[model samples]
Target: FNKYQVTAKPFFATDSCISCGLCEKACPVHNIRVVDKPVWGEFCTSCLACYHVCPQQAVQYGKATRNKHQYFNPHQ
Candidate 1:
C-alpha cells in the first residue's frame, strides 16, 4: 500500500480498454463494471488483479505503471 498514495482509484484508459471484461472478471471485490465507461464500485479493495490481467495494458494504478517493470504473475 502507498503511505502517500495519490487517489486510490483505477485509472482506465477508456480508449485503450478493449472491453474484454477481464477487468470486471479480475476484480476480487467485484468493484468494476466495463460498460461504455468502466464503472468502479465502492467495494474496490485495490487488489490490482485486473490491472495485471489486462492484456491491452489499459488498466493502470495511478502513475506507478509509467515505465515501471511489470511483475507479470499469471499464476497468482
Candidate 2:
C-alpha cells in the first residue's frame, strides 16, 4: 500500500481544544499545523503522538477510529 498510504481525513480542532500547542510541539515530523485551525500536512508520519497528547481529545485521524486502542500502522 505504498501508493495507497493511509491518510488522515480533515480533522477539526473543536472548541474542546485548549490551544495548548502540545500536539504541534509533540509532532515528530512537524506535520501538524497549529494555527487558527489545526491542519495535517503531507509530512505527517502518522505517529499518533499528537492525538495521544491532546488534552481534550479533539484531534482525530478519522471517523472510523472509535476504539481506544486504534493504531495507524499495524506493522509498526
For candidate 1, the per-residue lDDT at 57 reads 79
User: Which residue pairs show backbone clashes in model 2?
Assistant: none
- Model 2's number of clashes is 0
Per-residue lDDT of candidate 2, residues 7-33 (tens digit): 545455667787788889878888788
Give the Cα lDDT of each candidate.
Answer: 0.70, 0.69
Q: Estimate the TM-score for candidate 2.
A: 0.71
Query: Model 1: which residue pairs collide?
Result: none
Each model's TM-score, in the order given? Answer: 0.72, 0.71
Residues 1-76 of candidate 1 have per-residue lDDT tens digits of 4544423464655477888898788777787888865667666666777777787777787676755554587676
lDDT at 27, model 2: 87
Model 2 poorest ten-residue lDDT run: 64-73
Q: Indicate the TM-score of model 1.
A: 0.72
Stretches > 4 Å off in candidate 1: 1-10, 74-76
